[model samples]
Target: MTEGVEQLYFHRARGLTVTGSAATAIAARDGRVLAAAAEVGAGRLVVVGGGELSALPFLGRADNARFLLNTLSWLLTGQYAPAGSELAKAVTHERCFTVRSFHPEEDLAKVEGSHVVDARPYRSLLERIGGGILPDPYQEQAAFLLEAELRFDEMPRVIREAVTTFRHRSNDYEGLLVRGLPVDAELPGTPADPARRLDKSTWLSELWLAGFASALGFPLAYHQEKHGLLFQNVAPTPHNAANLSSESSAILLDFHTETAFHPHMPDFLMLHCLRSDHDGIAKTIMASVRMALPHVSLADRCELFLPQFRTGVDYSFGSANGVQGNGPTLPVLYGNPYDPYMTFDLDLMVGETPHAQQALEALRSAVNKVQRWVRLEPGDLLIVNNRRAVHARSEFSARFDGRDRWLQRVCLVSDPVPSAADRRGSGRVVETVFAV
Candidate 1:
């Protein structure tokens, strides 16, 4: 074991001349000094030749594990030994390996009151303004939705309850689904491909989306994705089916916290279905941490709290994405252990330690054990609390026969006024300004 460690990590660093060598190499390989000691003013520096020796993968090597502790002890204590003397491993307690136990604060509660709404007055109001309400510039359309909300002077009891349930207890409910929205009679067929240009006229149910988002909070947009469009089209496009994009990707589309890597991700994401797939199996699935936490063992919970995982930025964030290091190391769960904030991605987050890998697997197992399922149809709007739940879509075949499934998607934040202050000009899209 000692010979292997010496050969692997301490090779090729022997010959550098040191006038003030406080420590010297005793187990070097290949005619070089692997370990050496030097001084800088009042401080001491222990230099290891092969930087890769410190990586996580090499930490399990017997001497490799002891090298760190011994080096730190000698440097901090200012201890010195003769040129040919080697530093051996020190004594340590055993409790470091056992995890402290803890319990999650909340249980995974299924979101209810999500599929109820009254369609009469809403449809009547739109019918009164003809079958269309296309306004120039997106801001005007948003403004019109705000003003038109007055049409429902007395919101239907059920719709009022549904909207109210979403605002005050959204974090608890996870999301709300409103059904029976007014769909246009003469609807355009499914888009054949991704938009070649930005076009708001193609919005399936603009007035409803804007009004719904306004009632909850103002809608938000990102400069990095969908060309900064405040509201984007979600449909099965041949171009994106193989990718992970929520807009048009139809392959299984794994569950993920929307923009888990973004510092200023939306607080809510709204999706209203304009058409369903020819087959009815493309159900939208959501998993809430509230429900999954109860199943996590205490040891896994402790491991999950350590910042040993890195999540990669989603592709939609655009070029230079790869250059950016995987986002800062952070725990899968943060904040109150009972009701913590969760940010994860099966495709992106990588664990750096054994405990982290164990925690990731435990969390994934818990999430996979339970889920909320919804099948979208015309006039159905799904409002997901972007903070508490991870969402995904079931795979469905897209024939591209102009009958593909179509939905309108939008990103929304609770308080747009503050975000607006940071936003440049009057544009709806907020670019990189704040850094977390």
Candidate 2:
């Protein structure tokens, strides 16, 4: 093992270095390609010489796997951004590995289904670590959790396979639910303060969900709210009834991406329910633009794919943090236009032209016609593919009697954060892109 190899292990690996001028991993040793890539005709190609580049990218030595995955991911997608590591320079080409390319479709999406895990095996596993999945220092906890064999080894095989499928095949639905995690039947009271808190015991269940999400993508955080807390408590607050924040009043939260206006939004979002609302009527709604697009006219779809709209920062960003200039005029849909990624905020985003406005409305109607709803219960985790679909919360009456709905939410980013350079410590929150 090299001095800075992080903890990646490869079995009987052979050394394969680029004999020609193609760029290579930084300081490869013991047959490891820390980095390397090149353009092959119209397709991109990457050769990782070191560690295991096979199967799961986030399981073994997730730290180094990120470097390996980012190298291949950028080449495949042609969306390259520096990882802020002085150790290696950026590669110039892209290629796709096992990670499946997304295929945009014109059909209405199917409702997402749940993959349940048995609680008995998980309970026995918890006894080994005193029932807590992560160690102290919350900001640094995710890395430790990722290293646990209990999480990686014991995750239900069916659930594991489904996650792999989503990672490879472009999904045509909103999100999937994972049920039967260990949660206390006797629940904690819903918190009311700005510092909404949960007990460590409760965190154990959510930690399992986080590990599941980490298997799909890198755990990511924002710098602005709660000083960029990795696990944010999504609950009702009296002051935020219409604020357009995740923690805003639980009055019908609109269907939108977790962070649409920001340049570095998370690729996936996992919301773990800590407590269910009293009436259970507070359903989480998701709308697949893919499913709705078939109903939309071609003209409206064309306008949406064009840069005819601009969006404002969600209130959670506050008024002071980032991108305060006139919001950039951006297309609602971009990327592989056939299987496009979308950015929309019904309240904060506005279409510049009447045609754009009509397109937005048409899109809303199309999505609404095929919306799917799920009311998450305790021990349930919902993973939304933020790239391919939009999610919103329905208006729920908040009794505020310590039993209102409570969910712990976290975001995942695939690429190494471009703002990693500005992170002061904790290595989680990136303050580089905004005016901090």
Report the C-alpha lDDT of model 1 over 309-394, residue by residue, as the tens digit: 87767767762323233665677777764467777676667789876887787778777765666788898888887777888888
The per-residue C-alpha lDDT of model 1 at residue 246 equals 63
Clashes of each: 9, 16
Task: Encode model 2's per-residue lDDT on 195-273: one tens digit a residue.
Answer: 4445654346555656676677677678776557777778887877666666665566777877777777788888888
Over all chains combined, what TM-score does candidate 1 have?
0.66
The best candidate by TM-score is 2
Q: What are the models' TM-scores?
A: 0.66, 0.67
- Clash count for candidate 1 is 9
| lDDT (CA) per prediction | 0.64, 0.63
Task: Locate the minimum summed-lDDT window of 10 residues in model 1.
Answer: 89-98
The runs of at least 3 residues in candidate 2 whose Cα sits more than 4 Å from the true structure, single-residue gaps closed, are 1-134, 137-143, 148-150, 185-187, 194-197, 320-326, 432-436
Candidate 2's TM-score reads 0.67
RMSD of each: 13.0, 15.8
With a 3 Å backbone cut-off (N, CA, C), the pairs that clash in candidate 1 are 13-32, 13-33, 14-32, 14-33, 105-338, 107-290, 108-290, 108-291, 114-177
lDDT of 1 at 40: 65
